[model samples]
Target: MQMMSVSALNEKIKSLLEATFLHIRVEGEVASVTYHSSGHLYFSVKDDRSTLRCVMWRSNVSRMRFRLEKGEHIVIDGSIGVYTPRGEYQLIAVQIEPYGRGALALAFEQLKKKLEAKGYFDATRKKPLPPYPRRIALVTAAGGAALQDMLKVARRRWPLVELLVLDVRVQGEGAAEEIARGIAYADTLGADLIVTGRGGGSVEDLWAFNEEAVADAIYAAQTPVVSAVGHEVDTLISDFVADLRAPTPSAAIEMILPDANELLRTIDELGEQMGRRVAQILHQKEERLRREAEAIRGASVLRRLVTLEESFARIGRDLREVIRYRLSQFEGRISPLERQMTESVDLRLRRSGEELRSLSEALRRNDPTLRSKEGWAEVLSEGRRRALESIKVGERFELSDGRVKVRAQCLEKRPLK
Candidate 1:
């Protein structure tokens, strides 16, 4: 053979293979299908004798209707190509179809059915997620993007959540064993919930989710497990066995974290409501006090007492005035009576003095001395007459010194003669 350049030979081989297998269909069973983080599907197609490597770009994978799994018998339409760098022939699957059940499918179904019969999927066996988890254990790769995403989401949602991260292999050899150990350790550490998952990947990349040990560990966990594996369309045995399933690692975080803003808003609203209720109660009490004050004002004991006192004082004044008036009238009547009595006494005294003076005058007028003087005068006249007559008759007279003496009886008889 003529010597050919490596690049030239590679080009010729690539052209020839592309032209020959441009529109060929191959039927086989799927094995080790892995969807990479780069959005490429890589797997092997195998039969009884041989196996071939295959790749399906994400653009074509989106068009596929069925979910692909390991050991699933399928028919594929693609062209063969030679990898110049590695010197390997491979198929670029353009279309895929499910033909029958694969070996891995039979085993998955058998295990699922056995567990279901044993009541593993029973509602009674399933555990509920805690309302407010105190601590959460994350079983995943230590520096994986899924861990960072979960931490970011959890911190933003609920910063107070205690995170216990178990650094372990999420995929490849011994991944399932490490994942099972992580779950057991989380339980021993008394975690509230276990968040285990990885970023989106192919079936082979997420094969740890299919491990019986991982599924059994999740199922046996006392703490609730939340499985977040692969894309939304991907389902794993761990998802069925776990207490809860999330579509992505971020979704698992959201499921476990509480919204801080919503809780704060609720607390604020409760405070406002309590304040309003208290204010209303105070307002009612104030109104009641006002009504009581009005009642007291209307029938005040002090006011009544003052009114009674005033009435009593007025009555006392009136009584005093009446007594004074009566006394004045009595004084007026008594004073005149006293004056009249004094005048009457004076008049009677004057009358008695007048009567006494008249009696004294009569006694004085009829005194004996005056009567004797008058009688002597009369008798003297008679005697003088008689003497004159007797002297003429008897012519007898006795004279002694300058006095005359006359006889009484005999001289009277002579006078009469």
Candidate 2:
């Protein structure tokens, strides 16, 4: 083996790598990425157990369709080269792609995940579309099919609604800025509703609506926004952030505008219903009035009422005549009976008075008081008597008259012989 300087050895290794592994293709995940101020990208590509250094020059990076992010699985198309200064080999990638549906899908998924983590895709953040829009703003590319379709549908649906057009770049470079500015400006214009979209195209052609700036502008708007980007299948970030999503630009117009013809038909139908109701009510009232008139015209009801009134008058006259006759008969009979009773009572009182006087005089003539002067009565002893055996000869005894009293004394005793 011949010994040589490190630079010589590096040069030999560089030649070997270029000659042997030129135009190589490798598949792995991005490990670390550094975008330099010099407009160069330095990164490492890795598998489970090994890593390879890689560099993409600014010139090539400018041509790339997508930016590299850490942990993204990708396939690199380039050649192997050795750096003599570092004595290490690295991949000089000309083109890089996502492992699957390529960088477009990767970029979309990345943005979606980022916005979702920030709660930008939450359903609660969405607002309700206005039921009626007096004025509508259309933010779309100039002369596109989407703008024309919207205009046509709006005119047919509700011609009264004023259409305000703010044409902008729908896709390509600077399209996102233009679309964002249009949304903000339209929000300031006091339009009742806003509809912004473009016709269907490839993901690259529709990428402007998916940009973060457009989504943020739509979210910040005070007026409601309806996003109709591409076909029904094409969903973008703006669609999620806007107040409403329509499958097509024409569909958005349909949502915001009411059909004038249909409204007129409804109004006419209502007027007819009202007329029928009013007619029915008048018919019912007229039928009721006719029934009442027929009842009043009938003669039987009037005849019954007259008969009852005559009966009540006849009863009143008969009651007055009966009371007057009974009073006259009581007056004639009571006058004679009262005079006879007074004469009989006077005769009976005179006879009873004479009989009482005669009886009383007879009784007085037979009374004992007439002879009291001749029939004087005396009592010898009124209260007590004393026997001779108990009295001395000189003892006095009293003889009492009813009017006067005399006292006497016994002086001698006499024998019976």
Candidate 3:
């Protein structure tokens, strides 16, 4: 009405709306929600008769505990603002919360529903915790009470286990991502088990455990994971997805580790029982030996032994008699055989002597030395017997007749006609 330019008129409306609606709150059912890649949230709040457009910039949206989903009742705390280019007024949300519930609680229920549908909480898929873990990857805040409690319990229960403290933020903004990354890294550490948790706190303080990222990490762990968030009454999505759930950090340590003192007591009992059993066995053996010795000392046993010896002596006498009788029978049977053998041996010796004498006579008759006894001799030249004609003239020769020898020089050759 006052001849204002288009930009100035729009600016005036924006100024009025922003001033009047500053630090206001509105509750409605959400619709047309869009989570932009730029991290801004674009959505609408609608009622039966009216609708309002809303936007939460990335900075504020990043701080929100839960997502803005369509048809959800939400309360946004912000003021009206104008997009001057479009001259559109919208609610710029600075803070948002679920209409009737805490944002973290709502987020917890939402994530629980989503992951449950995805089978994150199925008992069949849960890994069985180790009875005695050799190494444990403790995923928690480094200096928090949770870590101290777990360590104390572990030391008291099982000092043998190797605890690898994987420090991570257990609460506050971005804590869920840190926890998830910690779990993933712990899986690579060859730990027999993983225990992740923090000390008790408010729902917001423990909200990281309720995050979907933490739940997914727990669900995907190869190592058996034990969720021990907050106190006994508090539960998180991690508890549902983990292989096991403990009421508290200290309880997780106790749940997974054997009690060293109890084990020592058991060992002592076993050792005593073993010693008693050994003593009992030795006593049994000694009693058996004593009974056997008593039996041996009995008069009846001595009598049996003596009777056995007498029987053995009688058997020996009978055996000797049988041996003597067998020898006599063998001697009787061998007498004729001995006589015939002696007679045959004497006849053979006599025949052999007669043949020997006959052979001697024949050898004497055919003896070449006998010719020498009848006046024949062998002539030799140069140590060999040769014809007189073969002897070279002037060569020396020898002749022997029986017991006589003659040496002569061959001076002439002579031939017999």
Candidate 4:
């Protein structure tokens, strides 16, 4: 027999137990469970016959998806080893899973229950999207197909909305953390809406959106957040916590953005309706005026008013005809003068337009030609200038540009001023 110190005996036992149970699976109900402040997990698993002490270091605990609870049946995979200091044998667990379900599934149920109790999925807490969001931020993987899908949908729908794409990992390790950070950062931007999503994939691939970190960030965002992950059938934790849930990345854009073509069509329809309404109003007003006028005419005391109105109407018709005839004659006369003055045709037209406006006002006062200071003109007959002394009384001459042509009999011969 070999004699050994207590420390050496415990060391030998540790080496023997570790070598014998290098890889084993133990299934039992959890008994005593403690999550140490040092980040290690200490627990015991027991059956009816025996109880086994178990310990998982912080490194392994960090990788676990679900929390362990006393009385829950679980299966731990690890090797048995001796704690040399305490001279006790224990199971140093490397991995743990629920007895009959996948760890991820159990984790999903647990987190969903926990967050649901916290009112994370309350519909009243979710924000309504702006009817016409001017700026939208997309939190997604920059190079992923999901980003491309969203971009295409947004461009096709509302191209005027400015899109800010924030790149982040959407899958694999550290993806949830990146997604959480991306959401929080996107909220700082003054985006009217924020969309975070990825393309459809397997459960493992889409697990980042199921993470609690992502859910927490989505809940805390100031901007309206839309979770668009996986297919219509696939729901995630982030979707529940987001302000809105879209079935897919492309669907998110379709849901939030107003279609440009649809808006244009609506505007055109409204304009047509407005024009029709205005025409209807004018027709109603005109009919009312005619009825009122006829009623006034029926009264003998107002009969003179009807006659005066008719006279004014006739005068207005005659004045309009005279103006038209004068304008036609001036078109030929003004072209030559405009060329002689070295003025642009547009400049002449603009000045003539102003003169026409002034002429309309002068017609109200029975004045036609009011000479401007710039140019002078003389009456012409058969392409020759006619002096006032050479014309007879009651002989009519055409006026050009609303200016009066004088007849010879109107004035005696006088020296020029």
Candidate 5:
């Protein structure tokens, strides 16, 4: 101490404190807590008797399940050490826990029960998963294992679906606010479905899901949501409020998809059933047609036609006989009349000829030859008489002359004597 420099003295003190407190547990009320931008956590631990400065490395801070805040009663496990450069003594806390029910935890539990009583977890409120979801929104840490698991499962089961990852913090201050904003953003992007959760962790690690803001956001989402937080045994408020809940991210995908083989088999079966029905209908129609044909063949249509033909033939024969009888009667009547007419005409002609002959004979009798014969006979008788008279007179005249001359001779002789 008399000859030691400041740096050497500080180093010696640091070595003494490190050796004195190897591992210890301290119970105190947290105060003046601060988180550096460097990712380290600093706080003061105070008991009734004393207070100590505590520092947790960024590595351990990253692993913490809960947020560190001032005025919270806590118990921590760490080692007391001296910082040689700063020449200060401090506690290095490796692990820490709240002494009672944490304020954040109390709030989470109260809100969860209230929402549950309002039927937020009711099966009736849950929506059905789409048969084929084309777009899926994811609300979780971009770098976390949860997002990776979801991608793997979605791609394996339904590769055709589009994935939209909305990266946001899953824990710590303002983490719940970021998650709610992510859910709203996904809804605006027109995601068909949403899968919101994180990898497995303790109750405090998954406290973001228990947030009132996160639950309200899930309930308000227009798209259907699938909650996959922690392992199967772990349940968060988000799981109850979402449209569907799965034990893990992989299970969530399986819940939403249909088996391709099963669907194809169903289609084939329906086709076969339809084919059989159509064939049965056709067969029935064919049988009906056959029956109709047989009925037509058994009917008496041909017999009716033959009867009609016979009746027509009988009428024709009767008509021909009647016409022949009428023609024969007409001919007989006309023949007698024609014969009488011929006889009458011949008789009239003969009578006229006889009358003409008689008239000609009368005319001949009164001709000039008869008159001339009568006249010639009269003339011959008259001429013969006249010739006889003339001869007698001549003889008498000759006698008278001779007598007169003899008488005259007697007288004259007497006178002369």
Candidate 6:
């Protein structure tokens, strides 16, 4: 075994580590922190299972955007180094950033905040979605769930709308460039709307949407663009830059396309309401017309006399002929009825006179006064003969007819018994 002093060995290790890891990147959370009077930062970085010590000199610390604290997740760009005195390996951090997110994430957030300050996300600036989009451009991968889901939704909701799809890679290198070009191309085609999105994935997988190139592309697009990346929980730069942000790819279609059946039903209901309104108006007009007619009829009595007087002066010859014709027809109808009534009255008077004469003859034949007028002398003789038989020789009696009475004495008495 080759024997060497500990100082010599430590120096050899330091030279080898510095050369081998001259530049590198590390991601972890800060477990502990220390700030020195000389403006140096010292902290331990750890993951779920292991830890590493990191240091930033005052020269590099001035370049950092954030201060290091215990339990803060961060990424360190540095070289691996060995401390000869302690014989330990450590990271000499050139740059330090919040770890869970990469430099791209930080950039994304910075741009978002900047755009927010500029009012890019203001509701007023957003273009209204076309109520009936006739042409649509889809910027997404050729064979992906996002494209398929959106297609299904578009077809189901509104099949008449034309969908123009531009295939583009959504992940890996050169993806952001392709996406930006696709957006520009789709817009140049005069599409009514543009939709760009992908299915859910890791943050790295969705990094293309976070790129500034994509955000600028969306902002520059003349046509309205809908951003739908990953699932509901995922958010990216394109979401803010675009005119609208949908929770998912399919939801973008749902927002832009209206259901045809629902529109038809609404049209039918409006038609029925219009018909009812027209009918009601017509009925009201009819009632008003009837009232006007009645008013005209009531005025006819006074108006007709004045009208006849005026018209008689203007066309009296013509109207007089028509009136004469009507009066002659009325006379023809009344003549027979008048003659019949006159004849009936005369015959009734004649029959009444005959009945009066017969009744008078019957009353006289039974009258006692009529009998007194007949056989006056014969009655007086009969009564005198009866009295003489009953009279004694010296008796006196009164004998008379109805008109004359005489007083006499019995001169002889004859008893024939």
Using TM-score, give the best candidate's number: 4
TM-score of 4: 0.68
lDDT score, candidate 5, position 358: 83
lDDT of each: 0.82, 0.86, 0.91, 0.90, 0.80, 0.85
Give the lDDT of residue 68 in candidate 2: 92
List the RMSD of every prediction in angstroms: 51.4, 31.1, 20.6, 27.1, 50.8, 36.0
After superposing candidate 4, which stretches have Cα over 4 Å from the reference? 1-16, 84-87, 302-417
Model 2 C-alpha lDDT per residue in residues 270-373, reported as the tens digit of each score: 99999999999999999999999998886588789999999999999999999999999999999899999998888888888888898888876554454335
Q: Against the hidden reference, what TM-scores do the models get?
A: 0.48, 0.64, 0.64, 0.68, 0.46, 0.54
* Model 1 spans > 4 angstroms off: 1-99, 295-417
Q: Which 10 successive residues of model 2 have the least lDDT summed?
A: 370-379
Ranking by lDDT: 3, 4, 2, 6, 1, 5
Tens-digit lDDT track for model 5 on 79-189?
A: 998878889999999988778666456456667778988888788878877898888888989999888877887666667889888999998788989999999889899
Worst 10 residues of 4 by lDDT: 367-376
lDDT by residue (6-102, candidate 1, tens digit) is 8788888988998999989999989789988988899998999999999999999865545678988898989998888766789999988777644
Between prediction 1 and prediction 5, which has the larger TM-score? 1
Q: Regarding TM-score, does 1 or 2 come out ahead?
A: 2
Best prediction by lDDT: 3
Superposed by TM-score, candidate 2 places the C-alpha of residue 45 at a distance from the truth, in angstroms, of: 1.8
Alpha-carbon shift of residue 173 in model 6 (angstroms) = 1.4
TM-score result, candidate 3: 0.64
Worst 10 residues of 5 by lDDT: 405-414
Error of 1 at 330 (Å): 71
